[model samples]
Target: MGYNFSRFTRGIAPGSRIFAADGEPLSNDMLRAAVPSIFATEAHESRSARFAPVPTVTVLDGLRAEGFEPFSAVQARTRAEGFEPFSAVQARTRVEGKAEFTKHMVRLRHRSLTNTTGDSFEIVLVNANDGTSAYQMIPGFFRFVCENGLMTGETFSEVKVRHSGNAIGEVIEGAYRVLEDAPLVAEQVASWKAITLQDGERLALAESAHILRFPKADQDGEAPAPVQPEALLRPRRSADRATDLWTAFNVVQENTLKGGLTGRVRNAEGRLQRRTTREVAGIDQNRSLNRALWLLTQRMAELKSA
Candidate 1:
């Protein structure tokens, strides 16, 4: 699936329309009309005591002051029986020519808009009323080709702050640092581009990834079932077919995220059954898998350098 950065870009456009796709200014009126929970107060009552309320519009205003525009915004749809399926809203409304739709997560890309290679820096802020997750800010690169939000660093690289006073300042500052460090990311990508991968090394990385995706059985249990490493290494796009470590890593990463590669596994009845692999969709799993692939490539490059 192509990851559309249009959702990230629409918010930052010069004439942003964050409320309706019809091109209107993003305002409290629009937000409240579209999603009432954003403006809900204790007077409306009944939120869990643990709900650290971060008023969404307030944060957007702060971002605007700092020159960061909202491109996409969505409300967390209640899984409660009646309402239609909803997702975490993207952070901005649409301007005349911007993208459309909603999600609960608000994304703000760096205003500087410097492209390190084909990727631009972005920060995603996730807020939830259901107590399932904390309000947190994530830093990542938005790849133009595939529209993938490639996260940097480890799973815990996110900066989590309470919704209380100055959270916006902390978020802006954290994002500033993340964008400023884009050079480091560029350096690593450059190194990977320079490092060629031997067939053996590439296969080894693929084998490790297969294990990560499908772990071996417990010590006392039967031996783990087998899966072809090539299944995981297959390139999903033509651009990923090169022999360098960077290309290998991108191939693996895209395949992992895109899934659908088939493998045989033991069913509950101990019969071998062909099953399609699941896409890496959850926030935690995407981070873990992407970071693991990146680290694997980094290690290979380091070894090659030495």
Candidate 2:
């Protein structure tokens, strides 16, 4: 599904709407309004009898009992246009009861970790009742400076629980497993902060990110990147102007994901037209890009240390 990001709006990705609270736990009413799928009581009809249904609210309640409170919730909409019959059928199946089975993500923070300043760890929960997704727990960082949510690299293990018997128990277990790695994420951030990158190194990272965002042409050929790599290096705020690897990563990440960079692209008629990059809106796209960027930064840090 294509996703669109709206910085000025409540929605984060296209086909998705997000509600986040500022240092406060989101209420049931808030989550229901933003991502009703989280409150789903049953699985979609498409799922086979073998597919055990576990409501996300069950997991949320389980986490709450463990002192974790959800602050952000988002759900994917099943609306789409398809030309093929099979595609149309799939779309219909997804939309039939999408409100009860669509993919949703919730971000929660443990009460014990609340006092930490600068950046705080969040347990990002992703699930769907339509058999499209399993219970996924990923380590996320909430940056106070930019109000950005960042997923950590693969070095920080992601816990997943398949839709089956005892899934809720497994998910609750996985949440704490992810929580245990919070300090390690903080250590990684501190190390990145300490490693200052020269302008060339920063540019190299941006160039790599540019390629990730806009790949080279295939046999069919594609337009060049909408913006130069240097554009990604531009800081949104003074706090992000530092030359450290962490700051540089944030600069590239924000620019790449939030987009809105003005540039020229060749039209079908071969004329240059002004275009602005779109925000990374798809949940899968967002997570994939965020994780890839994190991996790139990790590799850069490793190379620098070596």
Candidate 3:
């Protein structure tokens, strides 16, 4: 059973790994059995001031350029073994200045979908040492999830596992651009494991030049929205052009968008250019979900004029 907290106590204490899958307390033995080795000798560091993630662009946009794909893992079952590629939902992401990133181990269950019935599992991101400010990813977390005693394919990205619960995640296939995808292991009892980057992955990304790169996230309207005209997708085969354009535009935004710790605060001359819209036209939902918030404000004026 999970521990009942006192009114004086605010929340679940770290190391209190109660299985959100059920009410059972996740024991240390269970944790070790899932991941035999634990993060040991991890250097101590102070917490970075909390900052809400800007949006999904942090990983999505970057991965997309690297041929990354996303899916809603728990929402539908037709693609249980894969991704649905639709059923879009709002994206939430933020970044703080130079926060220390940590690696985490995940426990997985495969047939839990059939025998269990509901969501398979969720991703919990908290301090591996002491849990706090837990952030949720989505249907799942971690680049790799163990299924029925075997590891699923890996996601082409690695993120600071945030949150304290769990979510579903889709397995991604890609070149060894992401270190996690490398066929190397670091199981030294004294060392933390990490994936090494492959040379081909490096060359592929190096060839994909940045169309729009911003040092910091300027309010969307602060600068004119840069326009692209099939420069990247010119040789494109075929798909929903609108969705393509939208996703493409997101490609631009994700690649270009910067967040809080961006920009220089020199004297008063270089103050960030912040803009507020009174009325504008054609600000339809042409880009990605991450742009929704920015689009909302921009559209306020265009909508009024419409």
Candidate 4:
């Protein structure tokens, strides 16, 4: 029941009589007033997420054509709505200097499958620190000696570590350097193909991306690949070397002392009490021990430095 100036205007000027679809006269003033209420219902306050203000290109105008959106309508309309440019997202889509939402990291790491055997693969974020390693700047350091970096001259990379397998065998961590050669890489690629897998474990491996150059021993008829020392540069290999050195040195010292001295050698602490245990029943036990354990430990620690 809107008032019409023509009917109620007593004498307001006449133009079109605004009418409902049924042709009932509706006043022009009421139509003008209703537009505001309609717009109020529709123009909500959306959070602005761009470094630059989104162009007010009506609801239908294209961004680039209007010069308001970071990308043109053709571009933005094709991608997800939130798919802002990386730079724009970093600049404006912030929660205290960080994007509220962004791409996440996917990483490659080496895991020792067994004491003598091991494998490397990719793992999604598994630890808070791995989530923060880039900021920390320090390189990977973990127990079980994944690889000897410095000594072997191996380049380092992010490697998430965990102790599995009941850790019964030699505690070891393996480090890997990516190969640059296409064919060998292709071969290794074929090697990591899916094998039989146990429950709740991994079997397939993404191709190794680490590319390091080192010296390699001259081979026979086979085409000599990039001359880097693949085995020597491996962390496990270098750690093994340090370990072997430790063992050999201990063996020589043990044999020399065993034959040259009866039991305990006298030192500045002369004639220290040698509590000898006697197994009267010819007790026999076999033990394999590394003489260079400390040296290996030191060497391993140093290798990880690089």
Candidate 5:
């Protein structure tokens, strides 16, 4: 759960990890080897490409040439009977290791000054391949103290590249955008930091976020009992104890997405039952949460502006 966040919080230098101390790319053979679906020889009968299918290797090679190196990789496993052989995998490589993953999501940060204090702008890239998802890059932030990975719900900052002949080119172009948006991103962060929430507003945000992330809880005319709103306010890490809007937002974000925060509700029998929420693991949940958080952040920003 803390795998991605811990690494990012440590601020692992891209140059340090991407290359050996002697200055060469670290062994990405391990990363490359994990994603055989992209290199599989057998054709996927269901997915016919308009152009020749671009090998994942080709995309990685192109990114590498541009100074990015692969650090982490993940692939979706297919359980359906016919789609057994077809799977989509995504590897995250970074420009000098500025991005860190929180449960497979990377926060791309941009800073204008070498010694600037306070928060910077960030984008979150969830390099995913469910065999259907376009390569998605969304704006996000990484909090140094709390080690939270936040997907800023700024729609204009989002970039997507379809799995086509131009996929690699599109991806490279998007990467450049990350570097270019430092000022705008940093400004947004400043706005979020300036906005502090009262306890009522914080809890209301949590309740709304609960429904937003877990709409299934409200299905079938029998809504799942709500989790204690305060539970969402509990910090996953000690560093996150601040009372500002950013900290308040992360409390909800982490609880909703990382799971294991306990909550209870009435069962069909009208008996109380407790369940520990799990991190959002499914690709669909991931996407939904990404969008939801982005929207929530925007709302907070607006509220602050108001």
Candidate 6:
């Protein structure tokens, strides 16, 4: 139940930082400091001439024009090796230069859908000027209770725009496409909230999520998972203690990604050592795991109804 909120606030990648708006639209200055990649004017130099550079800022401006206000932003850190480690200033310069071209994600809320109660849908934008990623938009849910941003299942279509011609126009269209699907996502959440899980079902859900976070080598493998499956069902806050499918999904998702549970693991010396799970800090891994968990819960709901 004791969750480390700081770890969640820290950016998804190493050396990265996250900036969230405090009841106001995030300023360009703040975003530039936290996610310089968002403002990159050109692609990485390694990119070939055929690789057209679609600056993320251009798409972001286009989204803003469509009334989508960015609330949070984060960028992955890319380090250049073989730098002069002795000079701290040079190392800092190398990191800053690479940061401008790395991958970044921004969470935006439509002005029309902004509210102060319950969960609301968000447009999650991911892109990179370095050709590591295309301009992708996914539907996200912002839970007010825990301030968690959850990526929806594959039921909500993801929009991707290549860096070629009219990329900005495509991205803006994609944002609206996600916006149009918000009602369906809301209906899904409502259904989840209405469906309550029995104790066994909750445990089953936890077990499945555990396997996802810590897969076994084989049935005969001696090494056990660092944490028990049941542990993930423990809610960080009292409000999330319900047995409803939505609550169960959020609890498991948070526990799996923001791992801090203690358990025992066999070390290289063949002795049991106390170990704690680390958070899923990679941008792509976070998105994939979140989507997988959502799909798992959706399947469970279908089975329960059948």
**Model 1: per-residue Cα lDDT at residue 306:** 95
- Give the top-scoring candidate (lDDT): 2
Q: Which scores higher on lDDT, 2 or 4?
A: 2
For model 3, what is the error of residue 118's alpha carbon versus the real structure, in angstroms, after optimal superposition? 20
Estimate the overall C-alpha local distance difference test score of candidate 5. 0.52
Q: Sort every candidate by TM-score, greatest first.
A: 2, 6, 5, 1, 3, 4
Give the TM-score comparing model 2 with the true structure, all chains together: 0.89
The better candidate by TM-score, 5 or 6, is 6
| Shift in Å, residue 42, candidate 5 | 8.5
RMSD of each: 8.4, 4.2, 21.2, 32.7, 8.2, 4.9
Q: After superposition, how far is residue 144 of candidate 3 from its true place, in Å?
A: 17
Model 5 clashing residue pairs (backbone): 4-101, 14-96, 14-97, 122-140, 123-140, 153-294, 260-277
TM, every model: 0.68, 0.89, 0.21, 0.14, 0.71, 0.87
Candidate 2 residue 216 Cα shift, in angstroms, is 4.3
* Local accuracy of candidate 6 as per-residue lDDT tens digits, 1-306: 111111244334343555464658776777777777788888788778877777878877877887888877766545456433322211122334666788777888888886665777888888887777888998888876776678888988799988888888888888889899889988898898999999999999999999887776224745677788988898889998888998999899888887778888676688988977767656676777788888999999999888
Question: Over the stretch 1-306, how does candidate 3's per-residue lDDT look in tens digits?
Answer: 000000001111223222223323333355433322122222223434342222222323333454333221110001122323222221111122111222232332222222222112222121222222222221221211111111111222324434222211221121122334222211110011122223332222212322222212235435432322222222222321222222232222222221111222222365544432111100011112122322332233233235
- Model 4: per-residue Cα lDDT over 103-177, one tens digit each: 111111222211232221221111111111111010211112221101101132323333223221111122122
Off by over 4 Å in 1: 1-51, 69-79, 82-104, 114-116, 155-158, 216-227, 265-272
lDDT tens string, model 5, 2-77? 1122122112212211112221233446443443443332223444655333345555566557655443333433
Compare candidates 3 and 4 on lDDT and give the better one: 3
lDDT of each: 0.55, 0.77, 0.23, 0.19, 0.52, 0.75
TM-score of 6: 0.87
Clashes of each: 18, 1, 21, 17, 7, 1
- Best candidate according to TM-score: 2
